[model samples]
Target: MTALSERFTTARQEGRTTGRTAAVRARVLAYVGLTKPRIIELLLVTTVPAMMLAARGWPSFSLLLATLVGGTLAAGAANVFNCYFDRDIDRLMQRTQKRPLVTGEVTPRAALVFGFVLTVSSIALLAATTTLLAAALAAAAIFYYAVLYTMVFKRHTRRSTEWGGVPGAAPVLIGWAAVTGSLDWPAVVVFAVVFCWQMPHFWALALRFKDDYARADVPMLPVVTTALSVGRQSVAWAWATVAVSLLLWPVATGYGIGLGYTIPAILLGGWFVVEAHRLLARIKRGGDMKPMQLFHVSISYLALLMVAIVVDAIV
Candidate 1:
């Protein structure tokens, strides 16, 4: 009986330990999900390459690590705030219904406090590791996305995507500032490349979920305009994005980027424009354009272009 009691007690203790471990793991995953790690990955893709070009080679490992860490925290904070405010609409949309807040994995109060902590910590990290300018840019990005884009333009205007591009593109500027401690025309041109890219990239996504936006009463371009109008505007923005990308070749001459960068820019930009035109043509044919086709391609286009920039600078 004594041996049996000891065995029973050990079994119960192990069961309790296992249950506690599982609960802790679940809570950690829930908090990480609130950060939107995938979006943070996309933002960091633009950031590190811009740092490479700004340095005209590999930046110090410490600087690269610091910038990426700070940028990810800032971008994540912005996304967390966005999720907090949009939780209601998010529950109504198929794509977002499973987000932490909507699914009861995280509470609004917790998300808000998490966002606040991330915001303050990110700014302090950038200021300490990089420059005041980089920190300020990161702070501005958080504010612009959280306040201007989420609270104001997204609900009120059809042109919100266009204006929201500003904060999305700010990562390039932040990356450059981290290296140079300042901004210039070249940095602005690189910033414009990202600025222009956002329109078509997001419009394609918006087209895919027009019904979601309509249900949410959000005024995404596709929600408020004809398919033809969305297609045409996407093509126009694609052209503008390609033009700005090429401008980087000339503008970045001082950074030692040469024809190697130019060739890839033209080729990739041409392919992107072709995809945009195809999207338009599909729309004109009275058929579905499968906007995710363009949406996925746009991500690859940006990643490849950033790679070209880094390679050109090094070569």
Candidate 2:
């Protein structure tokens, strides 16, 4: 009958509408994935604490929100640029094989255009909402990450990750500068903490992915060096990360961090160092070190340290 035909047509149109909606949602998620949200999240974790320490308490909500949003976009832009530049190699790495560029979910030309748009927008947002210095630091961090590290160090040297820690540590400085409008010794000390922490944090991750690096012809330390060498280096930097973090206790004297910060620093820092040594010991015994365990713990270590900073500063 005519009624049955109309019902069939309505159902078909509804199905088409649902399909289009789903496609649009997937496209949006693909664009978001290109930003590497996880890394940006970790960077932001360290940022607010640095801002709190610099202010000796909570900063204005508007300023805090602005700094966080700008930092996210800046880091997102840098990550997008890295994806564009590393697209070819990314397709070869097992971990990166599913990335937007690799799977053709996003085109290279579109990715580059997106990166450019993010670059302009992030810088302009920072400059408008925060200080010029904050904006400049964000720009410098982007270039340091996408250019110096991605293009130069990553290609030629085994020590690339170590040398490339600056951009990873930059959010701390950027956040402090946003609050104080200048850099100080405390900022430098915090920067060193993040820089030192990065070596062990990433080396553990690199150990698990070294095979992928080798497949891609990248010169990561784990790819070029022996496991024993990697373990020894990780241990040394782990201890150095702990020492540098403790040094912040004294340098942050006027910033209101005290026993509250000190307790967590000693406990968490010592635990991280112990975990690093555990990896070294396991390697010496010719056993699997479960590098990913350290990798996961490292994330917790830095996040808790920043939490302690926030609590200590506000109280």
Candidate 3:
């Protein structure tokens, strides 16, 4: 009987230990989720290629590491604040209902404090390891996204996503500044390209989530406008995005970007526009536009375009 009781006690202790470990792991993941790491990945995708183009090849290892780390932290900070501010709307949206804050996995106060810490750390990291100009751009991006876009325009304007592209494109400039220590025409052109790209990319996503936006009272274009109208605007922005991408071919001459970049830019831009027009055509036929089609392709377009830039610079 004594031996049996000791066995039972040991089993209980092991179960309690396992439960505690699982709880700690859940909390850690919840905190990481608040940072919105996937968005940080997309932002960094633009950063490294810009750095490569700015260097005309691979930049110094230390500089690349510093820029990427700083950019990720800065972008993460902005996203955390956005999540905190939008937690209410997020709870309403089916897509965001599982977010850490909405799920109660992380407290609002904890998320807010985490955002502030990331903001300060990212800025200091950038300033210490890269040029002050790069640090300033990172700070600007954090402020623009967390304050301007989230707090003000997102709730008020139908064009919130459009204007929000400014900060979205800032990583390109920040990456360029990190490498060159100053802004230049290539950086500006890349910025413009990203700015134009955001419209179709995000508008497509907004279209996909129109019902959610409406439920949440967010004034996204798709929520406020007809599907056809959204498709038309996406097509128009797709044209502008392609046009701006082509402009990089001419502007990037001094940076060793030539036919290598130009050819892929034209091809990819054409494919992107074709997809945008497809959405418009679908909408006109009174069929479901399947905006996620364009949304996914846009990610590919941007990734390929950046890769072309890197290849052109290196070759």
Candidate 4:
């Protein structure tokens, strides 16, 4: 009888294990979707190497991995919260009208629950596995985006992209702090690079979706500005990004990279400038605006630029 009871217990345990595995896989994929993997992939491209550079060699593998996990969770939570908050408006925008919540694939309450659980789990994990400073920064980034940017700046201002840069820049700083245990000049440089990079990147996107944004009453820069102004703003931010990136070499001793890094920065920055100028010229000539082209190029440039930083570190 005892042997029979134990066999039944073992069988029950095996079944539970299988069930848990399936449940976990589904939840993880859902969470990954919330993170917007494409965007998080680009964001993490900056994070790991920032940690490596801060350590001035290789970062601690455990800490780096933990920070990435926490950062991904925090970012995903923020995005989920934003989707829930903007479900109504998102359903009205062409680009976002088909997201999980907007399409009724996920209920708003479910999204809210997911966001809360992910947010709490992220903060707890960071606090346990990494420095509190890193954890705090992660939380602040989420709050900045979910509350400050999503709720306030995005709905209220023409320069929402500029204001949103604050949170967008935080991941770099969070990665740096995770390894260094404090904010420093190197972290500041990384933050500046991301901040300046976001301005043009988002402005280009705004140009592409100006009508969607306007129809949604989101108050994006392109929605309120003339094409000439959008072009000029793009040129200005792109130039500023290039200037800021070059300054990194002199700011941190770890920043020295061969002309390989400089070459791409200059060429890409120049291309961005030319595109902006061409857009302005097109506006003047009454030609079609290639906002989509500029928008896609901007994404490529930012991702490649961050990859360049990591490559420089490795080489």
Name the candidate that leads on TM-score: 2
> What TM-score does model 2 achieve against the real structure?
0.98
State TM-scores per candidate. 0.97, 0.98, 0.97, 0.87
The regions of model 2 sitting more than 4 angstroms off are none
C-alpha lDDT of residue 278 in model 1: 93
Tens digit of per-residue lDDT, candidate 1, span 1-315: 999999999999999999999989998888889889998898888888789889989999999999999999999999999999999899889989989999898899999999999999999999999999999999999999999999999999999999899989999999999999998777788889999999999999999999999999999999999999999999999999999998887788999788988899999999999999999999999877899999998999999998998899898
- lDDT-based ranking: 3, 1, 2, 4
Number of clashes recorded per candidate: 0, 0, 0, 0
Off by over 4 Å in 3: 1-3
TM-score of 3: 0.97
lDDT by residue for model 3 over 1-315, one digit each (tens)?
Answer: 999999999999999999999999999999899888888888998999899999989999999999999998999999999999999899999999999999999999999999999999999999999999999999999999999999899999999988899999999999999998998899899999999999999999999888999999999998888988989999999999989888887788988989999999999999999999999999999867788999999999999999999899999
Computed on alpha carbons, the lDDT of every model, listed in order, comes to 0.93, 0.93, 0.93, 0.80
Selected candidate, larger TM-score, 3 vs 4? 3
**What is residue 73's positional error in candidate 3, in angstroms?**
0.6
lDDT of 2 at 296: 91
User: Cα lDDT for residue 77, model 1?
Assistant: 96
